[model samples]
Target: MERRGTRAAVRTATGTVRRPERTATDEDWPAACREAVLGGAGLLAALTALDGAAGSLDPLRGGLWAALAVTLFALLLPPRVTAGQGWLSARGPLRRRTVRTDRLVSVRWSEGIAQRLVLRDDTGRRLVLDPRVLLANPALWHLFATGARTAQASGALLCGATALRQLTERAEERTARTLLAGSGRA
Candidate 1:
């Protein structure tokens, strides 16, 4: 049993057991970064080529284009996401936000130009991240789900079960697809 404002202990048949803390980060982050950088470089190259062909290429114009490319790269870069036993975090170029998954109060999907998963915990800590990060990294998803399950079992999670279920279904489907593809039957 758990009390309000107190951490609960998990007991097994033999004795109390604690979950080991482990961290999992998005494994595809490097590839995504490389893509962003390549995209920026490609844009800069194309613009410079066009400007030179039109005899308008100058140092100031080239510098401006370079700056524009850098800004585009920054905008295209994704946040780095990581999860541990009881917490999940997303670090963007500007800041990092983290939430205690084991003390989650709500989980919701925010639909927009880019869909995002929003997590809020009992302590008012919140984290927003792209759901694709979890789909791309199973280890991170495992850690996140483990903590969410603990919170649900302890009645700390008051909302977002449906959202979690939807994401779970997507993960399972993706796994099945991957298996089938690997077997040449997809």
Candidate 2:
């Protein structure tokens, strides 16, 4: 069934009207961007205030400080992720990457300061995104899971069943916790 308010209509080349596939995006992107901007501004303000009180504020120095703040902002900015019926995309400050989830060849988790979910498709396309985003957005998760299942069923997915299972278990646990807490039974 097609979801309401999620699809756009398109006219195909065969003179047919069809609903174009919908894409789910990271819903918390606005808040993340706001946090990035606030952090950059706060750092810039602190540096300026400190320099002004120390009698060291100058245009060249101020320019350099501003540049630093801008750099920090760019560095802190998270990639925007979007997913469709068969594809997922991550757009960063410099470029956008997409992978066909329905033709996936590999999936894995990269451990670091922040955990990242990495996906690769049969066409050699790759994308990496934060798993927290998927946990927070059901629509995005649904689309991604559907595509992953399709790939697995078609024998295209080879290396990521464990990763996907882990995520599914996590999501289930989180849901159970939320339900229990909401019902005052936690």
Candidate 3:
């Protein structure tokens, strides 16, 4: 049996495995550029145009406008998402959130302007993340998939297994398509 420090392995319906939450590597990053600079620049320009020059406005008013412009520009910045062996993290300029991907007990999908991946782990901690984070990072996706599968096999998963299945199928399909497309002679 494999060992991860002093933490004992936990048995699941499939078999015994090391404590994933502890054994898995931390994955997540901040400062991931989403190339929103252009939009942010336009926003800053538009706000400045609408509000007029900082020099022309009263001192306090100019300072407030400058602050607002900076805030808006910062908001337009892209957030970074990372997933490691057992963890998933999303970092933004304003805040950073993380979840133990390998310990997740429940996952729910919420649709909105941006799709939300709501996850709850054994520790009672909750994380709301972008579903695109998984779609974009295969390594991160695998960590969650493994944990979800374990949870499913153990009957600890309350919901969203079907959604995970669909996502897996889609990922597999894309992989097959890419492989086939590139297999032929040029």
What tens digits encode model 1's per-residue C-alpha lDDT throughout 73-130?
9998998898887999989878999999999999998666888999999999988888
User: Which stretches of candidate 2 lie above 4 Å from their native place?
Assistant: 1-15, 111-113
Task: Report the Cα lDDT for residue 72, model 3.
Answer: 66
Instruction: Supply candidate 1's per-residue lDDT for 51.
Output: 99
- Model 1 segments more than 4 A misplaced: 1-21, 110-113, 183-186
What local lDDT score does residue 62 receive in model 1, on the 0 to 100 scale?
A: 100
Query: On a 0 to 1 TM-score scale, where does candidate 1 land against the true structure?
Result: 0.80
* Cα-based lDDT for every prediction: 0.87, 0.87, 0.64
Candidate 2 residue-wise lDDT, 59-90, digit = tens:
99899889989898988889988888899888
Total clashing pairs for each candidate: 0, 0, 2
Q: How do these models rank on TM-score, best leading?
A: 2, 1, 3
Reference-based lDDT, residue 49, model 3: 68
lDDT of 3: 0.64
Itemize residue pairs with steric clashes in candidate 3.
Answer: 27-84, 28-82
Please provide, for model 3 over 1-186, each residue's C-alpha lDDT reduced to its tens digit, 9 standing for 90 to 100. Answer: 112456566787888664744233223332233335555556656766666754454657656756765676577665566555666666677888777766677788776698887888778877787776666555556676776777777776777787677777866776677678799732
Which of the predicted structures, 2 or 3, would earn the higher TM-score when compared with the native?
2
